[model samples]
Target chain A: AQTVTQSQPEMSVQEAETVTLSCTYDTSESDYYLFWYKQPPSRQMILVIRQEAYKQQNATENRFSVNFQKAAKSFSLKISDSQLGDAAMYFCAYTRAGTASKLTFGTGTRLQVTL
Target chain B: DAMVIQNPRYQVTQFGKPVTLSCSQTLNHNVMYWYQQKSSQAPKLLFHYYDKDFNNEADTPDNFQSRRPNTSFCFLDIRSPGLGDAAMYLCATSRGQGGQETQYFGPGTRLLVL
Candidate 1:
């Protein structure tokens, strides 16, 4: 089974600043994918970004970028220019490349953006 | 808008009563998944259906059951509601079984066991 670990339970960043959330995963499959999801107070989970295992180039989406080290099985999310609306519970998830609709999730990291 | 839809955004049911939550997807995805999330916790996978093949997580209790009659509809049935079972249930779908396809999620059904 693929397991994702988020080391930080809580993180705080000043508005317009940057923050990084750590994530590590254990998987035997050679090819897979990594993801970050944000759940705000509305409790709606939205996709932040994704990384493919085969690609050495990291994945980035606007303010949300990922530093993916495939050899080390490390996929961390970096939120740049954090805003007040960025305050939410962020989760790191993993899934194999094929025939797997289920995602293995990390415990969660509560991101708080301050003024 | 064509997206994942979960009916009854909120549910209030008596303990030991049977409650059913419905999900419909207009995206025509081949895979559907159900997740259980407690307050401030990461969503846990309860089960998922891959083209009618039900795959339940090992830790998921027998009290929880799901049915996907067709490509567009799925249901989560709690045979006997328990206090512990009260939580937000999320329904999601993806075009295929692969992880990179992006699983679209519904707003979710918040179950309250009284």
Candidate 2:
């Protein structure tokens, strides 16, 4: 069984600044996927960014990026030029490369963007 | 605008009452999934349908059931609602299962069991 862990339960970042949410996972599979999902107050889950284990280059999506360290089993999300809209509960998820593989998610980190 | 749509964004049901949540996708994806998320918690997979094939998680309670009549529609049925069952139920879809395929999610239905 794979487990994702987000050590920080809450994180705060000033507007226009940057914030990084840490995530770590335990998985023996070499080929897997890591994802960061944002759930706003409306409770709508949105995909932030994703990283493939085999890809050495980190994945970047607009202001959202991931620091994927396969050797350390760490996949952290970094939000740059953060805006108030970035405030939400961020979750780190893992899935093995296969058919019908379910996602294993971290506890979550609540991000707060303050002025 | 291909997307996943969940009906009755908010629902309130009495204890032991039966409730059903519906999900429809315009993406015409082959895979549809159901997830349960409690307050301040991550979304937990309950079950999923790959076309007509149903896959349920091992720990998923039998109280929860699912139906996928066609390619576009899927349903989540709670046989007997309990207070513990109150949570946000989310609907998601994907083209297929793989590392590159991304799962698109709906807004979700918040279920309140009284």
Candidate 3:
């Protein structure tokens, strides 16, 4: 079974600054996917970014990005130019290729954007 | 825009009572999934339907059941509600399986068992 871990239970970032949420996973599969999902207070889970294990280059989506280190089994999310709207609970998830595609998720990191 | 929709944004059921949650999609995707998310925890997979084929997770309790009448709709039936069953139920959909395809999520229904 694959497991994802987000060590930080909560993170704080000042407006316009950057913050990184750490994530690590234990997976034997070489071909897999890593994802970061954001769930706001409203309880809607939104896709923040995703990274493919085979890709060496990190994935960037607007101000959200991921530092995917397959060798270290680490996948971290970086939020740049953070805005107040970025406050939410962020989760790190994993899914293997050619399978049920059921996501195994980390405990989650609650991000608080402050002025 | 085509999206996944879950009805009864909030549901309150008494203990031992049965409840059903409905999910519909306009995207016409072949796969629909149900997830249970407790407070401050990750959403756990309950089951999913690929077209009309049902797939339930090994850990999912038999107390939970599901129905997919057609391509656009799926239903989750909890035979008996317990306080432990109170949580947010999420519905999602994708075109196919594997890690490549993106799954779009619904707002989720918050269930409270009294």
Which portions of model 1 show Cα errors greater than 4 Å?
A: none
TM-score of chain B of 2: 0.98
Number of the top TM-score candidate: 3
Query: What is the lDDT for A47 in model 2?
Result: 82
lDDT of 1 by residue, A1-115 (tens): 7788898999999999999999999999998888998888756688999888999898989999999988888999999999999999899999888758578889899999999
Can you tell me the CAPRI class of model 1?
medium
lDDT of 3 by residue, B1-114 (tens): 888889899999999999999999999999999999999888899999888899999999999999999999999999998999999999999899888778888999999999
Which regions of candidate 2 fall more than 4 Å away from where they truly are?
A: none
lDDT of 1 at B38: 86
A1-115: candidate 3 lDDT, tens digit per residue: 8899999999999999999999999989999999999988876688889898889999999999998889999999999999999999998999998876788889899999999
lDDT of 1 by residue, B1-114 (tens): 898889999999999999999999999999999999887677899999989899999999999999999999999999999999999999999888866889888889999999
In every candidate, what fraction of the native interface contacts is reproduced?
0.67, 0.71, 0.69
Which is better, 1 or 2, measured by TM-score?
A: 2
lDDT of each: 0.91, 0.92, 0.92
State the fraction of real interface contacts model 1 keeps.
0.67
